[model samples]
Target: MKKSFTLAEVLITLGIIGVVAAMTLPSLIGNYKKIETVTMLKKAYSEISQALKMAEVDNEFMEEWNFTAFENPDERVHHFFDYYLKPYIGTLKVCEPLEVGCMSDKIQHLDGINERPHAAGKMSFITKSGYSVLFWIHGDGTGGHFIIDTNGPHRQPNTYGKDIFRFILTFKNSSNVYADTAGYSKGLKAFGAVDGVTREELTGGNVSHAGLKPNYGCKSGLMGLYCAALIIYDNWEMRNDYPR
Candidate 1:
């Protein structure tokens, strides 16, 4: 006759397995989300950068456009999209600037500081690739900014420096390109990157709406503005030791 374990022993083994899973599952899932966000962010950056380059190849020099001539901010925004972006940006729906119907009002400054405490955003559009484009033109039309949401407007982690990121654009001497605004916004209060700690503080560990990282000096008040550059600085990957 084959020996069998007692019912109590079988239950004990199963219970132990459950305990282990309960302890480890959340961490595993958290890491998975981090990886997912980074992947999409990298893809989004590459796509937008390439698209900008293509647009530059086809359009009139930005300064020549005289975007600021329009007194209405909304019209300035619209002409930029229609003239430079919508052609190859693969737009899905072009909504009125800052309209809740397309973009979320979730802009923040990183150090736990919210730009619009109530989530008021400006003009933007939804792209076919599942990202929202917050495209802006300077009043003078010599420069602009591109703020993108990697996971669309409605997804969780919609916080800046998490899913929402910015790209600065300028036109000089008839050449247009993205400026180096990839890291933290210039002149914001920063506390992480002292020596061995940096991007991870903003992009690594768990993300909270408050913008504070546990056990890390990365306060989100000013970090959201420039954290996208962290991915660029990290060579397109969020290394395990980030924010250390």
Candidate 2:
């Protein structure tokens, strides 16, 4: 008498539950992915900014200084991963340090290593464009640079007209910049030689090659701009923290 529910009734209830899950699961997964991306970007930005501030405070000037300025961009890339990023993440096995021999003198090509790690344990550093972002410090004393894959068109995949986010920092005041029509050269001058204006104030909106789609950053609308703003904010906090 108490066992009144039939087999058909149980199956019907289970089917209804499954249908509800199927309808809502994809949306939940997509939102989780977005949150994960935002968190990683923020962590990467924080680590880089902290390293820059520490180096800047130790040195007495603020024109534009890159954490990796010793040799070519390739070598600097290895140094960045080995010294700065490794300390923050605390897992070297994930992103094996680049071999000394693989650090080439050439700045244009960045196929230096294979299967590099992008996020901590997530995707490998392989870009859809068959290239990866290369870290560099412009020959000038500026902060640093983010070079895009030059093998293919500079925009995101399938959007030929869109621009990539290539950034240059002015060590003078930590201004973030995009590439100009004459390539990064024009952007370089705008950072170091602008005269009277700080690097923070020298950024321009008209840079052609440095454009990217909107909503690229987790907090802001664009990743490059978000990175630039975070760098400046972190630097200020560092100054206050140390108060030299």
Leading candidate by lDDT: 1
- Residues 1-244 of candidate 1 have per-residue lDDT tens digits of 9999999999999999999999999989877877877787777666766665677678754445566687777788777677767787777777776566456775654455555422222467787878876766666555566777888878865666667776665554312222222222222112222223345444545543232344322233345554665655667655564331
Tell me the lDDT of candidate 2: 0.35
Looking at model 1, residue 13 earns an lDDT score of: 100
Candidate 1 residue-pair clash tally: 21
What would the per-residue lDDT of candidate 2 be over residues 1-244, giving only the tens digit for each residue?
5878899999999999999999999868855643443343344444445655554455544443354445555455555445443444322123223422111222221112222212221111223323333344443334455432222222223110011223353455332442311222222221112223233322222222233222322122223322233223344221212111
Error of 1 at 117 (Å): 9.5
Of candidate 2, the 10-residue stretch with the lowest lDDT total is 156-165
Taking all chains together, each candidate's TM-score versus the true structure is: 0.71, 0.44
Tell me the lDDT of model 1 at 221: 33
Model 1: lDDT of residue 2: 100
Report lDDT per candidate.
0.59, 0.35
The most accurate candidate by TM-score is 1
> Which segments of candidate 2 are over 4 A away from where they belong?
1-3, 64-134, 147-168, 173-244
